[model samples]
Target: MPSPLPADLTPTELVELMQRLTLEEQAELDHLLTAGLPRWLPQVGPQTDALESEADIVFYGGQAGGGKSDLLLGAALTRHEHSIIFRRESVQLVGLEERVARILGSRSGYNGQAKVWRLPGATPRILEFGSVKEPNDWMKYQGRAHDLKGFDEITHFLETQFRTLIGWMRTDNPSVRQRVICAGNPPTDAEGEWVIRYWAPWLDPQHPNPAQPGELRWFVTDEEGGDREVPGPEPVMVGGELMTPKSRTFIRSSVDDNLFLQLTGYKATLQALPEPLRSQMLRGNFMAGRSDPVWQLIPTDWVKAAMTRWSPRQEKGPMTALGLDPSRGGADKTSAARRHGAWFDVLVTAPGQVTCDGPTAAGFVAPLVRNGACICVDSIGIGSSALDFIKGLNLLVLAVAGSEASTGSTVAGNLRFRNKRAEMYWRLREALDPAAEPPIALPPDQELLGDLCAVRYKVAQLGKAAAIQIRDKDEIRELLGRSPDKGDSVALTFVSGIPMPGPARQRTAREVPDWRVC
Candidate 1:
């Protein structure tokens, strides 16, 4: 329950008082009263709900750069006397200490000798910062009482360490509240795996759980202590009275949810990571059934290097072409990219308009089409309408059907490419490969690079023949936060080996765009 209003003040008076307060004063009041401090990002605001709720266990985590650390720091910055923070080492706490100092007006009231903060107007608040480096370290707080305790990364310590701390979290003063805060990224080790198990109902899909990203859930139990999802059937008959259940919740976060981190290009670094690690760190693909060792279509490093390849910034092909992957609503992204031939380097990549109706998308790209640029449109899902819309513009167009792309079976230099989409993806790799004469360039987009790198392929047997099957958009969307629309938009550029959109200029040059039919 939220904090009650002051006994002497009515709702109207409280509203009037709130109206008179400035934004900074309101923020500080919110922080001091309800643990509602905010970080540089808004998604983390839900975490404050998790912190303030009356829960037996609360965990916040999932992906990196979610401002979890700063949250823990802010939660610990209260005037309580018995608040403590735990990390793997004391040096690890220094950064948080500096952050708290800046947040608390740069006042260094912490007395290192006593392990307490000596704010002038308040009682001497004991803030213990301890290290749980080994199993024996859990005993350090055996005799102490902590009203508030926070774990920087719970998985870094043994399960025993966490359980021991639970006992120490108690308060004798009626007005003082007891709370626990823990923050971490996805666990990468056995200890982390243990945490997932300990909180299986909250983290695992095997159980029927009712927790949302920030919502708290209450649970009761019988004598055996097994968690009860719903209570009040018999109320556990605790001492002939209705017993209340404790609450617990988990709040998930990712780099995308943190706007500040996104601005710093942290996502590109996560995307550049290698396979299973990349899936775990970037996509938060925890305990999933499988992650193919690779995209099977292209390597991540190759695309990353393509993003870094030195190329003239202002080069324009004799003719330009547009790649459009249309989406309607909800989770889909209407990605569109423009590239110049014959090198076929991407120049710009962006999302199309709202609703992404065929006509709307057609209108967005009509000017480019009128500039004599051919367009390769994904004629799948909402894209079919988009294709017709663009075609209705009386503009040059190449349609990439999800069904299949090639007229004859063999394509792209005698390779039995599965379908048009596969053929285009493979040819895109060929175009970007450094070994290929006249290496191509691509837009320096992190998401575009990540999606391109994530494409995978597999060979299938059809009795007497072998064929390649590319990973589909739905499968790709599961790993990527959204559909790989941008990547596919670029892939569409290779739909057909049409001549570079200008008068013939390079039949004799090795570095010129290849004018061959795939």
Candidate 2:
């Protein structure tokens, strides 16, 4: 009698056993097992490229109707041993779930309550669908591990939530592969702009070093938690420790890439949309929706022009001023900007975990403050603590309180501001104006650019006249999804005229003046 087949034979074990069988027997057994298996494979173009990409992180979609959702689902089903795909909300999973049911020919392996599909085999594969709706909702999956993680419509989620959930991507199974795949269209709003910065080498027109589509680049986090791109994929020494950089790439796909979508008349639908939306959806233009808001305090084009004029080799005057925006313990960061005449240096930031207290914040500022540089510090809330420490050291410091009354007007002298913050920000705006003498040169920094462009202004009635009032910090935070630390620091640079520090003078608590435009 023939030996009985093993009940717990894994796919790998079965493949090994098949090698010992006769050619006819092997063919017969292969036909018996796979004859009626439901088929789902990646489509021919960008979808296949995405599936074959060996990048640690891959961003796959640019335009709508590109079969992005199906790409995520098919990758999980066909290749991964354990996978989870996320949408911003649970309701978005309905269509995906239905498609999954059709592919399997039945819902027998699906556990709707747990939102997982357990494929039957000796080593069962697991596919899960989840949502992270709120900012803190990512904590729900804190410790759960998966070999492959997918984010659909990634721009709809906060960057923090995306980073936190991807921290759990891991696998112990030797047969499984590890990767993160994100699919989304270009961001439609200011809040989603982080995605552009995250993939700047591919998306940002002003990126110093641009990369072609599907080109691989490597990046590692610096000591301050900011990403720094390296030369190649090799491990490098950082902060005295060896670290390996993660490889990332972007693959652009549009409606044209999906023949099925093209035949369904999706191209015309995208073209019928409004101005910016139509351009964004049809051409996959990352630069769409970049027009400044009507009340935007600063124009986007002005900032871009300033960045273009800036070069590391440009001659700069002595460091004249320093601006500090300190943060209390939490997700916030303590940021500083140093100004030399019309040129500003790249921002320096320390996470709240490192610079939470007064002394710690002071420590970060002290070494950066030169002998003649006038230091401007935000004196509201936790910033006041840092200001106190700096003042104690006998440094020339200007304590900035945004809520205080404005002591200055626009450079043209015709416009008035509601408060010091408005006045300070307006000064930077005036300096950046194309017609202004001594044009400002700003370092190419994406977060600083976003912060400067995100704020809006309105005319507020002040007794007999109208004054320009900027929106509250809390409101801007809601729109940008984080505090405008970099913007605040840059604005603070203009709190007072660049003073020529004559001599070291003994100072009292009251000697530290409130923000006053010299």
Please list the residue runs of candidate 2 whose C-alpha ends up more than 4 Å from where it truly belongs after superposition.
1-37, 105-114, 118-123, 292-295, 328-331, 407-418, 459-467, 474-478, 496-500, 504-518
Q: What do the candidate models score in CA lDDT, each in turn?
A: 0.63, 0.83
Taking the tens digit of each residue's C-alpha lDDT, what string does model 1 give over 376-461?
A: 78877777787786666566777778567454333344455667777788778777777866666675654575578667888765
As for candidate 2, its clashing pairs are none
Judged by TM-score, which candidate is best?
2
Per-residue accuracy of model 2 over 67-119 as CA lDDT, tens digit each = 89888999888888899999999999888899998878889889999899999
Model 1: pairs clashing at backbone N, Cα or C within 3 Å? 295-456, 405-420
Candidate 1 wrong stretches, greater than 4 Å: 1-292, 310-312, 342-355, 405-415, 497-518
Question: For residue 358, what is the lDDT in candidate 1?
Answer: 69
**What shift in Å separates residue 449 of candidate 2 from its native position after superposition?**
1.1
lDDT of 1 at 453: 63
